[model samples]
Target chain A: MRTVEFETIAEAVADAAIDAGRVLPEDVLAALAAAHDRETAPIAKEILERVIENARIAREHQMPLCQDCGLAVCFVRIGSEVRVAGGGIADAINEGVRRGYERGYLRKSVLNDPLKRMNTDDNTPAVIHFDIVGADELTIGYMAKGGGCENMSRTAMLTPADGRDGVIEFVVKTVRKAGGNPCPPIIVGVGIGGTLERAALLAKRTLLRRLDEHNDDADLAALEAEILDRVNALGIGPQGMGGNTTALGVHVEAFPCHIASLPVAVNIECHSHRTRRIVL
Target chain B: MTDTHILTTPLTDEHVAELRAGDRVLLSGVVYTARDAAHRRMIECLERDEPLPIPIDGQVIYYVGPTPAPPGRVIGSAGPTTSYRMDPYTQRLLALGLKATIGKGRRSQQVVEAMKRHRAVYLAAIGGAAALIASSIKECKVLAYEDLGPEAVRRLVVENFPAIVANDIYGGSVYEETTECSD
Candidate 1:
């Protein structure tokens, strides 16, 4: 087994956290620029310009893009042939998150307990998802997910009869109900076919996909396009100021489920989409 | 289309009266900062019939919890947070003579009604434009609730802070106007 030092992983996670906080992914930036170009409403156009400018300032000055630096969420893929030395992977990740939040000047948003509501201070204990893969290499994907759009995410177990049209309708209605709350123009990640929790996870995972990329499956791609069209037609616009560009992208991920279940989840992401991936 | 207005704090009835939904505003002067935790505490103080930590009359309350400032900066990337969460306490605060609020997203119908009743307004800063927003804040000082960390109440002096009047005293709502036109 090829062993990766624990400190190496910790350092990488720390850098990823800091970088993700400060930088807007290029795909998101391009999508915002395109949205600016396509926008017809003068107010919407102005908002998009500010969004772009904000991203620029965040990068140039090494500043967290938004006041809400968000909870540190890391998705890890570890190969069976690889081993970590020194400490547990989760501990290492938590350490990294702690350092990153402190050193990067990112907001410490995590609370130790949901009900008690006490700040953890260091933004420790990142939400980590681990997967075992066949390759010898390790891959880590990180996202700084703010609370506003996350609060708008939804999951539903639909009857088989609901089908494609029902899914589309549910998504559109959710975005409409969310209105300006999720901070449009938003990116929607739709998870279909998995069990309830799995569907939610899949929906969030789909958000890590680049905005410019489409699902490889033609049918899924078409579904994404349809959802995007209908969501935009809602005219939630930029910051719900009302315009043609409510959503910048819609991505759909599906998995096989029990015959009795047709679960769907929609994960909403705001314009300040911050994410990064690292391979080790 | 409406003209952008340059407004300073301690807003008068005349200042609040002229604002309509969708008007751009360049706001300067002092505003107090509060978020979910701070608002909860403020309401608790009110429940006990204690005075608020900061005076509310004719002042703007920005719904934000800014990140800790880096060295040499007055404040870190400070921007508006979602406003609806504070809806429960908003009308109460407005009833106390709060002139206006600054935040992102739409407020509830009750809050809008309270705005109409109290002759206050709701303004929205660009939701995710934190760094850009910080440039407008010339100074920031924690006024109370220092234990709340980022959620601590702060006194901020801003210059030309950009916002749009999302809701007005006359029941005008930029959100509704945009939606109606889009449809």
Candidate 2:
């Protein structure tokens, strides 16, 4: 059994957060550039141009690509064979989040409560989701979810009679209703099946996948492509300015569910879509 | 475009009038920072007829809650938050003579109506581009609600701050006109 010091986790979390804060992940940037090329709406095209310019300015000046630095969320994949020593893993992760948010000049957006809405000041107590994946080598994925797109997310439980076409229609309508509110062209993550909460979790988790990749299931992958095509055909455009490139991509994830229910959740990601992963 | 207007911040009607939908601007002057919390407080203060924590007349309020600045820096990653969240309090500010606002996202119809009624303009800074905006800020000082943390009211001095006119005083909103499906 390998024992890792808590400080090691803390150090890794802090450094990773800082690095993620400074750079727009390569996949996100590439997706935006490609969107700019494919976008046909004049106004949407203009919005894309400004988005590209914003990235250039951010990188050149070493500034955050967008002002909403986002709430710190960490997904930890722990190895069952590895044990942590010196302190609690969760505490270490929080400490690292505090240190990195403060040091990197990323905004602390976490509020202590949903209704009262008090800023936590330090971006502490990161929203951490952990999974025990294997016997060796832990993987950590950190994502900063901004409020704009997060606010527009939706979940629904359709009867099994609704089928795949029903799911596609619901997703397209959700995107259309969201319009410019989520900061299009948006990346959509669709989670189907499982229990209601797990379906939402799967939707949020699917957001962590690479921008260009599709579902491993061939049928699901085709469904994802079809949904993407329909969403873009909405002509919501970049920044909802009106364009052919309404969606950057669609990703789907599925699991078996009770025969009575077909649950679906759509989590929209704004253009920035900041995320980073590290294996240690 | 070289014949640009160089206006001092806390923008006035004349400054706002000079701008049109889609016009590029390089604004320099003193702007104040506030977010959802501060906006709520400001509205509440007005309800009680209490003295405002910060003056609003002829002012350009930036919707931002910046990251803590590093040593010797004026501000950090100070970009606009989505503007619609503050929609409820906007008319109250406009009634008090607010001349301009800077943030991303489309404003509600009520906010747009208030902008026209009060002769105010809304500007859109690039969203998700905080670091780029910070480079334009030359000076920053806490003016009020320092305890509100990053949401505190800050008096900022900016130079060549880039923004596009999103809403003008003529009851026009670029977001509505530009969004193809809006019609």
Candidate 3:
């Protein structure tokens, strides 16, 4: 059995949070470069160029990639054979979030209540998802999800008869409705075949995957490609100025479902794509 | 590289009138900030028939809640929030002689109608271009609602701030241009 101290987890989370805020993920940067190369519209190209430049400045100066700083969504995969020694895993994570936001000068955007509208100040109570796995290790997947792209994400419960084409249509329509609001060229995460909440979670979790990677299933990969093509065709280019480039990538995650349902969800991520992984 | 145009603010109605959707401008000079909470309070003051804390005649309002400034910096990374979230409150503000609004994304239909009627324009700063945008801000300070932290209404002096006209007084919308081009 392996033992991990609470301070170790807290330290890792704090560092990852700061690093993620300052640096654009390499995969996302490469994806943006690819989009810039193919974009024909001069305005869209300029927008993409500025986006790349923004990332560079953010990295070099240690400034946040965006002012939103985002809500901390932490995915914890804890090894069944490992034991946490110092404190609760969640407490350590919240502590880390506090230190990260405070120490790193990141914005504390989280509010205490939806209706009451009070700022939490430290960005605590991170939305943590835990899973028990076989390896003797702890891996944390972190994303500082901005509100604009998040607000644009959508979900629909399609009948079983709706199937593949229905999914594509819904995804395209959602992107069209989203327009420039999510900050194109956005990454699209699709989740199919699950219960309502599961579908949403699958869509969000799929965003943590590398943008350049594809699903193992050939059919799902093909679906991702098809959806990507259709979404780009919407002509809602970067900042919706009109061009061939709209989405940077489309990632689809799927699961088996009951006979009556075809639940679908689209999680939109802005070009910032601030995600980091910590292993301890 | 596409050409970048420059404009100075507290923008005049004539300046707002000339802007077309998709035209890029680098704005300089005085502007004010207000987000959801500050905007709500401002509107409530109007409803109570009290004077606005800051008179906004022929001025621009940026939709933003900036991160805290680190030691020595005049301000922090300040980027525009999504505009539609403020659409409900915008028309009323425009009626107060506001000439322009700067943010990202499409404005509501009602906001567009108000812009055309009031001779105002909507400009978009790149959504994620906070650090780059912060470079143009020469100064910032809270004018009211200090308790809101980042959401406090701030008076800012910016120099060569970059943006593109997304909505214009001529009833043109950049959002409309994007969808129409695909057809």
Candidate 4:
């Protein structure tokens, strides 16, 4: 097995965190530009312009695009052929989060208690999700999820009879209910199948897919298109001020589940969908 | 562009009603900072008829929990947290003469009614724009709940603190008037 040093992982995580903080991913940028082109409302177009400008200024100045630096959430795909050296993986990740939040001047938003909430200062204790893969390469994906969009997410365990139409309706309803709160034009990530928790995870993972790409399943692709069209019809516009463009894209990822259960999860991503991937 | 309203530290119902949605102003004097935890405490104080740790009458509260400033700076990137989380306690606070609130997002129906009845206004600072928010704060000093960390209540001296009126005292809400995207 190839042994990778803890410091190496730490360094990569720290660097990736900083880079993710400064740069809004290219896909998000592209989506905003396209939305700007299609948006009819002059005010909505102006808002989109400012969003694009915010991303540009954030990149050029090496400052976070939004003040809510976001919770440090990492998805690591560990290789079976590789072993970690030095310290515990959790500690390394925490250290990396500390360094990244400090170095990048990202806001430290983690709080200790939900009820009697207290800020943790360093933005440590990243919500790390790991999967062991057969490949020799390790992949790390980071998404700086803001509170607005994160709060708007929803999940439901639908009856088997609900099926495809049910999933589409639920997702559209979630987005419609979210309205201007999630900061549109937004990205809707849908996860169908698996158990409840697995469905939620799949929904979040679907966010990592590129905006322009469609699901491999033709039926799913058609559903996504229909939902996207209907969502734009809402006229929530930019910042909910009124416009034709509500959602920038809709992405769906599915897995087979038990015969009785049809679980669905919707993860809403705001305009600043900050994410980046690294291989080590 | 600048209005000189001699409102008390924590503003009053009369003062709140004077403002409109989308008006920008420089807020001076005293205001407190509170988020989820502090909000609950303040409401609890009201529930028990106990005096609040700080005065709420005729004051404008900014709903923010800012990061600790780096050395010389008074405060770090200070932007508005989501406002709806405090919706539960809003009517109580407004009824007690808490004049205006500054935050982002829509409030509940009860809170809107409270604003109309008690004559309060909800102002919105741009969400997620922390650095820009920080630059507006001229001075800050912690007054209560030191252990709450960033969620502590503090006195802020702001010059031209930028905010747009969200819900006015007359029961006008940008959220109500603003068209929402459909799906």
Best-fitting candidate, measured by DockQ?
A: 1
TM-score of chain B of 2: 0.92
For residues B116-172, what per-residue lDDT tens digits would candidate 1 score against the true structure?
999999999999999999999999999999988999999999999999999999999
User: In model 4 chain A, where is the ten-residue run with the lowest total lDDT?
Assistant: A57-66
lDDT of 2 by residue, B89-123 (tens): 99988998999899877888899988989999988
Q: Evaluate residue A140 in candidate 2 and report its C-alpha lDDT on the 0 to 100 scale.
A: 78
Answer with 1 or 3, whichever has the higher TM-score: 1
Residue A271 in model 1: lDDT: 89
TM-score of 2: 0.92
Model 4 bad stretches (over 4 Å): A40-50, A113-118, B1-18, B22-31, B47-53, B177-183
Every candidate's DockQ is 0.61, 0.43, 0.59, 0.28
Kindly report which residue stretches of model 1 are placed more than 4 angstroms away from their true locations once superposed: B177-183
Give the TM-scores of the predictions, in the order they appear. 0.98, 0.92, 0.97, 0.88
Clashing pairs in 4: A231-B183, A234-B182, A236-B180, A236-B181, B10-B58, B10-B59, B11-B58, B11-B59, B11-B60, B12-B58
State the displacement of the C-alpha of residue B152, model 3, in Å, after optimal TM-score superposition: 1.2
The fnat scores of all predictions, in order, read: 0.77, 0.45, 0.64, 0.18
Residue B7 displacement (Å), model 4: 11
Writing each residue's lDDT as its tens digit, candidate 3 over A205-251 gives: 99999988999999999999999999898889998778888898999
Estimate the lDDT of model 1: 0.92
Kindly list the per-residue Cα lDDT of model 1 for residues A1-280, writing each as its tens digit. Answer: 8898889888988999899999998889899999999998999999999999999999999999999999988889999999999998889888888888999999999898999999989987789999999868798888889999999888889988888998998888778888888889999999999789899999999999999899999999999999999988887899999889999999999999888878999999998898889777
Query: Interface Cα RMSD per model, in Å?
Result: 3.2, 3.2, 2.8, 3.5
